[model samples]
Structures are given as C-alpha cells and as structure tokens.
Target: MEDLMQKATEATDDLYRIRDTYFPKDVNHKINTLQTHSQIALNILDSIPLEERKLATQRATYEYLRGKILDVFEEYSKKAEDHLSKAVKLNPSLADAWLCLGNCIWKKGDLPATRNCFTLALSKGPNKRILSQLSMLERRMAQGAENQEEIVAESIKHAKEAIALDVKDGNSWYNLGNACLTCFFVTGAWDHSKLQQSLKAYQNAEKDEGMKMNPDLYFNCATVNTYLENYERALSGFEAAALIDPCLNATEEVKKMINLVDKLDGLLKGQIKAKRLASLTSSLTEVQVKPSYKRATIDNLLDGLNKAIAVVGKVLFFIKHENITPLYYLVCDSNQICFVLTVYGMSNEAIKEGDQVTLLDPCFRNNNFSWNEKHYELRSIRVDFLEQVQVNGKPIPPRHSVRSSIYAQHKP
Candidate 1:
C-alpha cells in the first residue's frame, strides 16, 4: 500500500517536470504513466477501509492527477471529471484537482460548471495556466452572447489578466491574439490595430520551439496576413500549415490565392481585359447607379434567410467566386460576418479592397462554423451602395477562409 502511494506521488511529480512543454506526445507519455499508477492506487484504495482518512486522502491525490491526465482525450473525460471531483471533495486544498476537474467538465460542454471549478481552484491557489484557460473559455462565451459588448469586455478583462500573470506562457499569448481579433471584428475597429497586435502575439507564441508543431497557430498567422493583404506571406504560412495537417486542403487554397494574385497582376499589366479592372475598382457614386433593396444588419437578417435583405458592413478581404456565370465575392466584414456577394460585370467594378459596401437583396446561407475556426455567412450581393473610405488611417483587405469542408465541395 505504501509502495502504491509512493509510486502514485512520483508519477504526478514526473508530470510537472515537463509540464511546460507543448509536445502532445511527450505530455501523453507522462499522462499514460500517471494513469497506470493511479489505477493501481485506486484499486488498492477500494479494498482499504473508508474510515482510514489519511490513507484515503493520499490515494485520492492519485485519483485527482489521473483525472487530469485523462482529460487529454475526449473518451476518458467523464472518468476524469468524476475522479477529480471526488479528489477535490476529499481535500478542498487540492487546487490542482479542482483545475483538472474544470478541464474535464469543460470538455463535456458544461461551461458554467467549468468556470465554477476554475474559480474554486483559484481560491485555493493561483496558477497561470489555469487562469489562461479560464480566460479563453470566457472569451468564447462572450462571443455567443447577444449583449456582446458587455460579455466581450469581461472576456478581454480576463485575457489581459492571464497575460499579465505570465509573460512567457505561449497559450496565454495565443489566447490574447484570439481575443484581440474578436474585438476587432465585434467593434469594427477602423484602423485594424488589433489585427497587428494579434499578429505580434502569435509571433511571440511561436518563439516557443514546441509551438512550431501547432497547425492552428500557422493557420491563424496566415489568416492575419490575408487581412493585411500580405499575399506572399499568407501563401507561405498556408503552405507551412498544410505540411503539418494535410486534411486542411491548404494546398488547394494556395492555388486559388495564386490565381487571385495572377489575375490582379494580369489586370495591372493590361494582359487581362480592361473589363476586369472595373470589377477590381468600381463604386456606386462614380457612375449612375440606383438601389432597389432595403438595408439591414447581419444580426437582423438571420431570421429571413434567402430573402433580399441588404446588409452593410466594412470590407476586410475579398475572394473571387469561380466559374459561375455572374462573378461572386466572398467577403469578410469588420463586424464579424462574412458573406458571398455576387457582382454583375459593371457592378463588379465598384467592389474594391477596404470598401464599406451594402449588399442589396443579399441571400444569407450557412457556413460550417466549427467553434474555433474562421467562417463566413454565404450571401449573394446586389451592389446597391459602396463607400470606399479609410478608417482611422489604417485599413487592410478584409479576411476570408476558404479551406473549409464546404469550400472543398465547391472546388473553385
């Protein structure tokens, strides 16, 4: 029994030795070792008298760490949550146990309970890693709230706290990058200052060698570059990310991006028809144009999908819709909505980079928005009005994501 207790304690201690590394394989190996010991400890614990408070408590420590380790996989999350919950109950001072419980429960989609567990863990002892995770989850909740301003404020507050606590924690930096981007989209920051900040934060996170293996990090960096209109850099980033995750269809996206750049180049050199140039730089006021549709916000158009409800938003980036008879635009909005806008030959001339425009009689369709990835609202454009104005003296092309499953089927 004593040997089991010692082994259990040693196993947990081993976890901390490489705790800061971001390598999943290394972490998983340690977790598996800890799991074996914890299971043995639990078996011994089952046979021991419940009245043996000291021994029970010692064994409970193993159960607690075991739960935390199990949280790395979705399959073991329930067991992890159960064991960690019992561990914390057995000894309330086990702050780490509460933290593990928080993670497991969060994976099970209980956000409120996850927050509660993290709060309890914080009360016992402060941990930068735990704080960072809580902050990120808070930001996600805020993103979904209707009163987004209030909730996003809270999220930013927590994210800053996490960064302040740990200057070198890569996860905290990554979370801050995400928070800043969310704020940019939500608040419609004209200068796109937050986008730069997000880029910097992501770069700082990559300074950690272990973070190099993270495909999401590479994808985000690429997206930020797209927003900044750094086409070459964005392409490189996409390529790097694709090297890590072949399933992402990044190679196909790269081809599209290259085609876009070449098309623009052809237009500039008079290689492509002057007609295409009109599509790149046309606007409503420069010519005799009239609108036949009513305007609304993206929030308002959700109820009436496929109806001709106009929505106005600042352009963040543009992607060409391929092979369709009429030219289509995949545009990202500063207001956190992205939609597909169709342009007739003459009207396409008005659609330029960094223009704030309204889509007339735009039809709204759904995109596969899977929680953490970039997604957009698919809409057809009726180009009623276009205002190409500079915001806060800093404007970049709007951002768009095209490597999704939906995009795969379209294949253009």
Candidate 2:
C-alpha cells in the first residue's frame, strides 16, 4: 500500500516536470505514461475498502493531478473543474490546484470564478507565473469594462510586479508586453517609448527557454509591428507564428492581418512618388489625443451653416483633376449620411480614401438638397496639423499626384 502511494506521488511530480518543459519525443511519452499511472493509482485506491486505503494529503494531490491531465480536453473540462475544485477544498494550500482550477473555469467562460481561483492561489503563496496569469485575466476583463483605462492601469501594475519579482520569467515578460500593447490600443496613441518598451520585452521573452514553443508570443510581436507601421516585420513574424502553429484560436485574426497588410502594401506600391516620413509625424510631434473637433454627423454638415461646430467623417473616394491642386473626397459617417469634404494645402499630404478623421471649425457652404446635387463642401477648412491628415489605416507617406495631361471635369 505504501509503495502504491509513493508511485502515485512520483508520477504526479514527473507529470508536472514534463508538462512544464514540453519538448523531445520522450517527454510527451513520459507525460502520457505518468498520466495513466496517476489514473490507475486513483482507481486502485478507490477499489480498496474504505478503511484499508489510508489516503491523506495524497488524496488531494492525486485528484489535482488527474484533473490537470483531463483539463487538456474540452469535453472533460467540467469534470476536470469538479475534480480541481474538490482538490482545492480538501487542501486549500495547494497553489497548483488553485491555478489549475482557475484555468478550468476561465475556459468555461466564468471570468469572476476564474478571478476568484487565481486570488485564492495568490493567497496561498506568491508566484510570478500566477501573478502573470492574473495580469492577463485582468487585462481581458478590462477590455470589456466601461472604466477601461482604470482597469488597464491595474493590469499594468500587476504585470510590472510580476516582472519585478522575476525578470527571468518569460511569461511575466510576455504579460508585461501585452499590457503595454493593450494600453496603446485603448488610448489609440502613438506612445512611441511605450511601444519600444513592449518590443524590448517581447525580445527578452523570446530569448527565454520557456517561451520557445509559444506561437502567441510571436503573434503579439507581429501585432506590435503593425501598430508601429513596420508591415514587413509584422508579416514575417505572423508567417513564422502560423508555420509554428497553424491551428491556434488566433489563426483567423492572423489571416485578417495578412489581408490588410497585402492591400495596404499594394496601395503603398502605387504611390511611387511618395516620400516616407522620418516618423509618425512629418515635422510636428505625433498627436493621438482627441482633437478639438466636436463629434458631428454628416447631417450636421448638410444642415444650415454652423461656424461654431466641426464635423468628422471617413473618405470614400477622391476626385482628382488637373485644374484642382487638392483632391475632393466623398466622405460618409456611420449615420449613412454623405458629403463632399476636401482640404487646401494638403495636396502634398496625399489624403486617401478609407481615412477616418475629425474636422475642426468647419462651416457648411450649402444646405440645398436637389436630385442633381451630389454633395456639400467645406470652404476655407482649417487643418490643425499636416500629420493629422493621416488616419489609423496602414500608415502611408504623403504624395502629390495630378492628371496633368488631361483637362477634364468630374463630379465629386
């Protein structure tokens, strides 16, 4: 009986070691063998008479290990959760059991329950990996919350703490990088230094032995590159990740990115005369904050002239002519309202369709609505900065173009 208990304990420990450092054909085989031994140990113990099998701390450990193995399959997730929760109830001090339970509940889409499980694990002990996991959970929750900035700040705090505790922990570094990227997304700000920090953190994580097999790490790096407008690097990292694991949950997301990059790359190629800006801005600082433009609809622009208000919309198409220095765009808002929007002194900036922007101090010129009238225009429009002409799409350099050979007219 004692020999059987020892065998079970050894199997559990070996299983964890194999699980942590997943590599080599032998490690996978060893994990499977240990998982089978763990199940058999439980079965033999259960088969014994109630009084004969003197199960103590081993009971909780056995249940936890069995649950951990079962959690790998989606169909058995509920059963795994039950076993893990039971194990934690029997021995609340088992950090591994608590963490496993958290993972199980998270997969089941119980964010509150998952948070509780991780909190319980932290109560039991301080672990950098657990802290990093908790940070990721917090970030996920923040994305869905109304107070996004506040929650993101908390997420960053937790990730920073994990890194401070163990800079060598690759998971911590990965979580920190993700938290920084999340901040950038939420704020929609260039945040040059913060993005650089995220890239550095990702590089450090890649160097760590534990992060070698994680495709998501490379995926995150690719996403950051996209935000930085480094499309070539982004494509390379994304392709590398897809080759490593083509069946990830994020595979569709990667495909979308690939399509966007391809489209943007083709558009950029057509701009043969375009000159790349040295940075996100031409000569001014990168400004990502909300401009002074008030959120007004196309209906606002079509209404009577209001010099006090500003309107914003995305470009749909351009009407370029040899007679005109700047291009005219047919812009529309989410309200399904459309208008003719244009800019002066922006011919060199190369504003294109599919750009979302806000206009400041715009005054509508016409309110007449007739079948022949196609759009409305803004007279003497004021542009805050030339760089503000750029939008969130694939960032392209400004270019000047003209159908100088053709003397013709086209409706905007």
Candidate 3:
C-alpha cells in the first residue's frame, strides 16, 4: 500500500504538468505526454477509496484531467458525444464542454436541440463565437417557417446583432443576404432599392473565399439578376451554380427562360412584317378626285365615299384591337372612287384588293366634324358613309376638291 501511494502521487504531479501544457496553448509533445499521464491518473483514482480521497484536491485534479482528455480526442472519428458527455459529468460547469456538446448535436442534424444547447453555453458564458453559430441555426429555422415576413424580420435582427459582435464574420453576412432574399420571396415584389441592399450584403459574403464554395450564394445572385431583367447575366450565374450543385432548381429555370426568349423573338419578327404592309397600303391612296357632275351624281359619289370610309374604319378597328392607339390615315384615289386605309402599327392582315370600305372624319363628333387645330386634317373629310367597292388593278383617282354635301344638306 505504501509503494502504491508513492506511484499515485507521482502520477498526479505528472497530470498537473500535462494539464498546464495542453491548455491555452497546445504543443504536440506536451499533448502526447499528457495523454499518458491521464491514463495513469484515471487508474490511480479508480484504486483510491472515494471517502478517503481528499475531496477538494481530487475535484480540482479531476476537472483538469477531464479538460485535457477531451482536448486530446476533440476531433477523433468516433462517438464524440459519449466522450464529451463524460467530461460534462466530471465537471458540469465546464463552458467549453457545453460548446463541444452543442457542436456534436449540430453534426447529428438535430438543429433545434443543438440551438438549445448553444443557448445554454452562451448563458454560462456569452462567447461571441458560440453566439454567432446559434444565430446561424436560428436563421435557418426561420427560413422553414410559414410566416416568412415575421421570420425574416427576426432573422435580420439576429444577423445584425451577430455582425455587431463580430464585424468580420462571413456567416453573419450570409445570413443577412438570406434574410433579404426571404423578404423578397414573401413580398413578391422586386423592389430595386431593397434588392440593391441585398446585393451589398451578398458581396460582403462573397469576399470570403469559403462562401464561394456554397452554391446558395451563386443561386441568389442569379435570382437578383433575373429580377433586374439582366437575362444574360442571370443565365451565366445559374450555369456556374449548377456546376457546383446540378440538382438546383435554378438550372431548370434558366433553361426554360432561354426557350421563352426564342419564341418571343419569332413572334416579334412576324408583327414587324404585318406593320410594314399596313403602312404601305395607306400610302398608296393619296390623290382624291371630284367629278364635275349633276347634284345627284355628286350626292351619289359623296355617299359612296362615306360608306367606304366606314367599312374600312371598322376593319382597321378590328386589326388594332389590342393596340394602344387607334388612329389611321386614309388616302383616296384621284377619281374619289377608290381608297386605301393606313394603320400606324403592325396588322395581322395586309390591305388586299376586293375589300369593301368606308370614310369618316377622324375627329367627327355627334355625326359632325370638329374644327380642332390638333386634328384639323382628320376633321376635313365631310362624307361619312359605307360603300361596297371592289379592289382591282386601277390607278387611284386624281386629286380634286369635293365640297361637304352632308353639311350643306344639314344647314337649316
């Protein structure tokens, strides 16, 4: 028994030297030496009677040994939780032990439980590093909640606090970017001002090399570009992100947009052709003629012109049903017998020969022309009647002056 006590006292002294070397600053040679001493100390403790052991001395010694043992096996690929739990049992007030417990829980994917453990560690000692990590878990949990607005607001608040605590924290910037994006998603409005703020936050995160490895940052940049209508830039961003994570939805969305743009290009080309044809037809009937005939003959020609203008106007109205403006010019032939309608924009159908037509004062009000300087030309035409006329290969009528017969007839 005397010999055993001597060996145990030597082992305790070795354990103290090892503990001093292992903590605050680790040295490999000292750590290896410490591990050997720790095994011996455990053996000695096992042999000594619990009641006989000096309680204060034994507690201090056990606390030191527990910390050193945990450090030695910190990153071992085994049941780390079991080892950490044992250290906590030995010294419940060990703040570092609680931090290690939180990390193990995070690794096991119990995020909520891990968050609770981290909170406890922070309560014990408000370590900035642990608090930052806890904020990250909270941000993620908020993202998965149904009330996204409230979640994002809370997440932004936490991220700001984390940044205040550690301005250089890349994770805090990342969380801020996520919170801004979540705000955009919940609102469904791409407010450029808000998005610009989000872009700045993302830029800060991108400065950290490790952040580039995360596909989420790239995907988010692509989403912002898409909102800005920078299609080419958005496509390139999504492509790079897809290379990192092929299963990302951004890859498919970019592909779909590419196809949509192609279809729109084709449709736009067809519309251009239709617009050109309508303009050319309107320009062909510029000359108007007035046949010097009897009052009855003049009446018949005026009636025909009115009827033809009305019919053509109806056709023009249908052609431009979806257009913003409905104004058009009519060119009558020199003989005052034939006319062509001109529209401002593209029309699906070209003006063809054999179509019936009509004419009306462009600014006619209540069946009477209004002499407004802005629309003087459109108000000049007096006839407002429909005519059944055939389009044929014939030169347009010569330009001749025609009096407003409708006005003369209406004069009281």
Candidate 4:
C-alpha cells in the first residue's frame, strides 16, 4: 500500500512537469502526457488501502492531482466531469476545483460557462490577471460581431477598460488603434486628422518605444498623404517604409505608388499649360466680341467657337478621368510661315519644330521640306492661330525633343 502511494506521488509530479513545460507551447502534447500519467496515478490510487487514502494529507493530494489532470486532458470530458463532481462533493470549499472546472470549460470554447467559472473564481478573491485576460477575450468577441460600426465602438470601450485596469499594456493600445483605423478606412474619407489620431495611439503602445519604427504605420501615412495630393511627402514616406523591412509584397506596392506619383507630376505640368490657355481665351473672348460685328460673319465665328468648345470639353474629361492633357503648339520659320503643329503630351512627341510637317487626322506626319536651324520648341502654346512674322533677324534654335532614353531613365 505504501509503495502504491509513493508511485502515485511520483506520477503526480511528472504530470505537473508536463503541464508546466508543454501546455503553453503545445496543448495537444501536454494533454497526451497528462492522460498517461493520470491513468498511472489512478491505478496506483486504486491499489492503495482505502483507510490509508482517507487521511487528510492523502485525500488532499489525490483531489489536487485529480483536478489538475482533468484540467489538462479536457478531451476526457465525461471522466473529468465525474472526478470533479466527486471532488466537489468531498470538499465543497475547494477554490482550486472551481478554477480548474472554469478553465476546462474555457478550453472547450464555451464563453458563457467560462465566464461563470471565472466569476466564481473571482468571488473567492480579486485576481487581476484573470480579470485582464477575460476583458481581452470579451473585447475580441465583441469586435467579431456583424455590425462593424457597433463592434468598433464596443471594442474601443473594452480596450479603454483594459487600459484603465492596466495602463502599461501594449496590446490594449494596439487594439484601440486597430479600431480607429478601421473606422477611418470604412468611411473612405482618408481624413488626415483622423489617421494622425490613430497613429498617435499606436505610438503609445508600451512594449517598445520603437512602435514608431513599424513599417505599417509609415505605409499608412504614405497612403493618406497620397490621397491628400502631397505627392513629394508621400514619395519620401513610402521610400522610408520600404527601406525598413522590404517584404516582397510591400516592396511591390511601394514601387507602384512611386511610379504613379511620377506620372502624376508630369501630367500636372502639362495641365498647367492647358489651364493658362483656358484663362487667356476667356479673357480674349470678353474683350474682342463687339455688338457692331455683322451677323453672317459672327455666325461663322460662332461655328468655329463651337468646335473650339468641343476640344476643351474633351481635354477636361481626359484630365479628370484619365490623367491625360492635350497639347497644341504652332511652330514657324524665319519667313514667318507656320510649318508645324506640335502636340507634346502623348507618350511620343508628335512633331518637332524643325521637321518638315503635314497635318493629317489631327496628327503630324512628315513633309518634303528639309529641317532648318530657325526652329525652337515653344514652352507653352495653345490652339489659337498665329501668323508668321520675322523678329530681330535672329534664327531660331533647333527644337530639343525629350528623348526616350531620358524618359526611361527618369521612370521609377
């Protein structure tokens, strides 16, 4: 009998070691070892004399080991329920029995039952750790609900409660930031004020001061800045984020955004010229149209004005939807003969000022005349016609076309 009791004690110690070492890293392995040890201990208990086991020391040890084994090997639910029921019957005041039962139910993923058990455990004493963990689980469950806005509000409430209980918890702050960012994205506003607020909360996480060093935060900031059309700042922020931790996915996304910003910058320069032309034409129409003009001639001019109106309409539509701008420039020679109509904003330069040129279907094609030195690229010119006139006896410089090699080199 004494030998059997000794074997039971050793088996209990082995079970405890398995729980301490394996339970956290691997619940499955811990459960297997625990079941093996518990069977051995139970067989040893059966062999011991009844009178010997009934003593206070032996009875307490048996009950403690039984509860712990039940807690670990939860798959033996029926057997564990039987053992716990018997233990509670024998000792009504055993707090450990109640706690173990509560944890077992938690492992089964029965939250209401688990919360009841935890409440009972807390009834016996104030357990700060258990309370904190329960709050976190509650927050997770709340955030997983269907109504996203309500879930976010509830999550924020729970996170605030967790922080109130333990001010230094990094996870609580991180979770709060998640809730805020979700709200910002769902609204689709990309409001900088709201994002900055969320970022500040994440920055306050207690695990490390280097939460600010996290690449995700910087990438988010870059996206917001890009939406705000602060392209230069967005470019720099994305570059810094990619440098920190160049995951393949993030590297590809940042490269794409950088390319987009470069294209937008070029498109903006072209649109500036278009806007200037629009403004100039508006001013000219106000000053030049007089009531004394003949009706027939005015009607012809109105027809030409309607055509010009259609071109501006197309340009505006492309600018808004496709990020494209149309260019119209006239180039003349020393003899004041207009020889070229250049359009510069397409993927290719349509015409060079010195080239022999012919207009066909709104595009310029080559003509028979040889190129000349008296030609220069106009920086900004619009659709209005110009008559060639000699000025200052100086020959124009040869037009400089933007080269394909330079375009490829400047591309990110």
What Cα-based lDDT does every candidate model obtain?
0.56, 0.60, 0.48, 0.45
Relative to the true structure, candidate 4 reaches a TM of: 0.36
TM-score (C-alpha) between model 1 and the true structure: 0.59
lDDT order of candidates, top first: 2, 1, 3, 4
For 241-314, candidate 4 gives per-residue lDDT tens digits of 67654551345655654554334333433433544444433422222212332212111223112222111111
TM-score of every candidate: 0.59, 0.58, 0.42, 0.36
Worst 10 residues of 4 by lDDT: 310-319
Q: How displaced is residue 222 in candidate 3, in Å?
A: 1.9
Candidate 3: where are CA atoms >4 Å away? 1-112, 124-132, 143-147, 188-192, 244-253, 263-412
- Once fitted onto the true fold, the runs of candidate 2 whose alpha carbons sit more than 4 angstroms away are 1-55, 249-412
Candidate 3's TM-score reads: 0.42
Candidate 3 per-residue C-alpha lDDT over 178-221 given as tens digits, one digit per residue, 9 for 90 to 100: 66655554443323454666667777877886566566777777
Could you give candidate 2's per-residue lDDT for residues 19-117 as a string of tens digits? 443433444565566567557645644554445333556667667866876675333377889889889988889998999899888986889989999
Candidate 1 deviant stretches above 4 angstroms: 1-53, 188-191, 247-253, 267-412
Question: What lDDT would candidate 1 get against the real structure?
Answer: 0.56
Kindly indicate the candidate among 1 and 2 with the higher lDDT: 2
Estimate, for each residue in 129-212, the C-alpha lDDT of model 1 and write its tens digit.
Answer: 677777667766655456655665666667667778878777777777776666655553322476798889888888877577
Clashing pairs in 2: none
